[model samples]
Target: MKYDMTLTEKQNLTAYLISIATITIGGSVYNFAISYFLLNETGSALYFSINLAISSITFLIITPFSGVLTDFLNRRNIIIYGEFILMLSILLLFIVTYFYGLSLFSIYIVTFIRSLFNAIVNNAFSASVSNMFHIDNLQKVLGLSSSIQSSATFLGPILGGLLFGISSFELVLFIFLLLSLISFLFDYSINFELFKKENISNNFITDSKINYFKKFLDEIKSGFKYLVSVPILSTVIFVGVFINFFNAGDMVLPEKMMINVLDFSPIQVGIVNGIMACGTVVAGIYLANTKKIENHLNVMRWGFIICAFITILIPIPIYLEKHFQFNFLYLSTILFVKFFVLALINVPFIRIIHEETEDYMKGRVFSGLGVISSAIIPIAFILYGFIYDLGFYFLPNIISAVIIILLSIIYFNPKKFI
Candidate 1:
């Protein structure tokens, strides 16, 4: 099938894919190292909760500005700057570990810095993609991007786990820094002029320089106003938010399950996650190649339904571990199945978001979505941590699944909103 993308478009897309893969590998490594380090050192759920809360707040506070900056500045330059900042933060992590010793507070500070840079870079990157690709092709590109990210997730942990096993945390941090530096070079090498268009005045930024926080608040208001004015877009955002809410458990539960229920070593946990990443890679490629499916809304609805149903089966490993005895192959199979279903839904959903949004609005819209989606993650993490502490693992998954199903029904029903 002819995909209707030009040679230049293909080149740009390929560059983006490469860049994403590079950065995602670094991100995955950092995530693995920080979580592992924090859990081992502090051994305090409160510290984890605190770190998450600080990072979430930082993201929320900076996202609006990041969106505005994407609109106001050269997005390519913004991304390069963000990468440099990330590199510095990673280096600081290494310094802290190697010289000052591993302090939880210092680690939390680095995490906050890392998350802030992530917010900026992500907004700029999304905006750049929206500008470079036509709407019809957006979904395919997003699918491919998701696949790349998932593949990185699969490999990054294995590398991180191995490195952590042999070397100190400082070594892992140094590797992260090196990867970020490489990503920066990639960002620098890209020709921004290739994607440049006439800069239209973003009325939102006229007063932004005068009072940054006030402007941020107004930009956020404008974003919400835009959403409200566009019912279809608003509905889409709401649906996306609900979907994220349900899937939030997937992020936290699997690690906890691996450690607590399955009693797997860190390496084994990484392997299982790597297998799940393989599933996501496959799903991403499939979605990228598939021709336009009829009724995207229907596809999305069914995707969420599938995800909800699959989530119900997530407890199978735990159940088997308890009753049927610990079987490595069985647990891995169950986890892989769960991740496979999630990837199936996630790729399509990502495509929809990329396809549906307009270029000018993409940054703000995505930032808004990020705010809503991630706003609750810290809370969910804390809640899940408490539940685990209370010896209740299955309830959170069940509740999340049911909530997703209900939200999907509401989101898919045209009569409800339209």
Candidate 2:
């Protein structure tokens, strides 16, 4: 369906999308710069990892409260004000580094503060996108947004690398400040009041005469209650949690498998990563332009089945390379194909969140999603690292495949979900 908007409204929508893409790209690069700065300043790889852990902990602490606030407040204003705050933070970084000389502790403080508020902006902005684009074509828009974001996963690092090498710290910080201000201006043009419910009887009072902490707990509980009421949403989040949990070892396993088992060189590993990225872009573009999917959940089930089959094949290369001398590129081919299937999984998953979630509750839902999706990575990494050291190298991968296949079969049946 076409967008239901006047010319000016369409223009405003386009600007907001551009703002989202711009902010995402800028944020990605900025994150890379922070890591780069820390590594250079501390001269210790362990310090960089420590910084990441601190940032992750901060995210975990602030995300739940931010989700609640997004639901309570104005989304557009949150986005606008949030960007300005980010811009000021960048400016602070620039001044601190240029004048007093940057320290590891100072960088940590800045990153922690920004990470807390960035969680709010992320949740509010995501919910706002659904509110702004309520038509059936939300999938297409989300596809394009994903493509733009995935571009950052590749482009942001390259840009950050070049800037880190070529420019002064102040110059790089200035660029982020400029980008954040630009995003703030674009978001400011959008009036979020149009998307909010104004006539509600529960205007933050009459009902909340109980204890403050108890009321807060109840408000948070309402999100879970709503999720329990919707089987599809609960199932989707469950699917994300398990799949992402199993996939955590992926960060270490692929590199280990490529270098140790297949005996591939560093250059070959880089080429394989490039291919995976190319697959993401191609899949995102295909979904963005393709006709609407009438059976999103059914396709998602098939996507899971296909990925499960691919996962079974991935470990085959290790066994085969020792016996039959297949082409070394075989691993790359399988990895590329796997990511393509991963892209397939995203289409229905994003569509379900956009379509199934209620506008009023979207802030909480997206925030809750952020918490659930991220809450597993560290545990999975530790668990996988433990098992990978037990000499049963492929055991984790086997368990991963089995879990995906069983989840697809047991929980995500076509008849049940559809």
Candidate 3:
């Protein structure tokens, strides 16, 4: 791989980093904002389950189309457009909350729109990153990007939590809206010439001439067919699906663990999540700078194993609290350790996905992963909720960990089904 960077490439890199940072901040805030609002208003696990299910469905529906558009359009322009739509969605949420009461139905509608934009924006961002860097450099770039995203993740929740604590949800929406506008501006300023040059070889004109709906269906089918042709890609998507399914448990588990088990406040819960984000930031930086780590598939396999270990270990604090009446410091320490391990594992897993897929197919591969992962997440969320209600909160993690471990073993063994 070439190491030389042109002036224009440097500019594009700067623009891409800023755009991603702004978008991550806006997106992270929206996620925390909606989940917090719904938890406060409906005060039911079932409502949270339903909200997640709807969001997953929205992503499932939009991701394939977004993936196709990523290939056909200028990547930077696609990202800018997605940011504008996301900004509009935030404004709509503000309008609904200001005029009408914070009704569950209203929140659901706003969140669904936001989720649609999120899917598009995410696909665009991933595709843009793939377009910007070479395959060999992808892992490092992805690690750096993940770090930036993790930094946003660290800030967004803390900001959202503080704003929600001090002012109304409407005020938080106003802040998110302002941030999104900045993001839109940043996105618009990015040059798409390099992306256009790279994609000129693609038959965009002929592809664009097809009927929209039929084209969408064909694109979706083509993405799946492409994945099937590549054994590694298929395995990677399956791994991602399982990883996301169990990871959804994290959203509901923290609240349950804090309130019911540790008897902590919302602020404490926010602190814990912030700590996890900080760990992510550290892992991202470490992975980005480490140049000699070339065995991405093996790295990913170990990441899964580590993540599963952390997942299974999470219930230890609860067990201690129940049987031995541990202090808050002890419990928090355990949770923080678990989060740190999770962060360490996730950075490599994501790097592998970014590095393995070809640049042209990145959009479809990631979006296809999104579609499959989203389809499974709804069921996972609902199932976790039900099992939580049944006093079996640990069961989901235990089952998911076992499944992941088995899959990882199979994935590592070349003789097994690749």
What is the Cα-based lDDT of residue 291 in candidate 1? 76
TM-score of each candidate structure, all chains considered together: 0.83, 0.90, 0.82
TM-score of model 3 (CA atoms): 0.82
Which residue pairs in model 1 clash with each other? none
Return the clash pairs for model 2, or none: none
Worst 10 residues of 1 by lDDT: 320-329
> Best-fitting candidate, measured by TM-score?
2
Model 3: weakest 10-residue lDDT segment is 191-200
Q: What is the lDDT of residue 177 in candidate 3?
A: 85
Which runs of model 3 end up more than 4 angstroms from their true locations?
1-7, 30-54, 91-112, 164-171, 192-211, 243-254, 322-348, 354-356, 393-399, 413-418
Instruction: Give a tens-digit lDDT track for model 2, residues 1-418.
Output: 4545555556666777677677777776777888887777668898788778887988887777777777777677788787778788888888988999877877788888788788888888877775665456566766776777677676766777788789876777787778788778888887565444443334543455667567656767787777768999998887767876876666666677777666777767767787777677777788878887777666777777777666666666666555323534666677777777678678788778767877777777877778777787788888877776674556667778788777877766657854
Provide the clashing-pair count of each candidate structure: 0, 0, 0
Give candidates' CA RMSD values in order: 3.6, 2.9, 3.9
Q: What lDDT tens digits, residue by residue, belong to model 1 across residues 1-418?
A: 5558877777777777777888788777877877877777778778777887788789888887787677667787888888888888878777767888888878778878888988999888866765677556766876788788888877787778788888888888787777777777766766555544566466654554577767767777776677667666777777777677667667776778778866788767766777766777777787688775546567667777777776777666776546333545655666666666666666555555565555566667778877777776557667767776777767777888898888888877656544
lDDT of each: 0.73, 0.73, 0.71
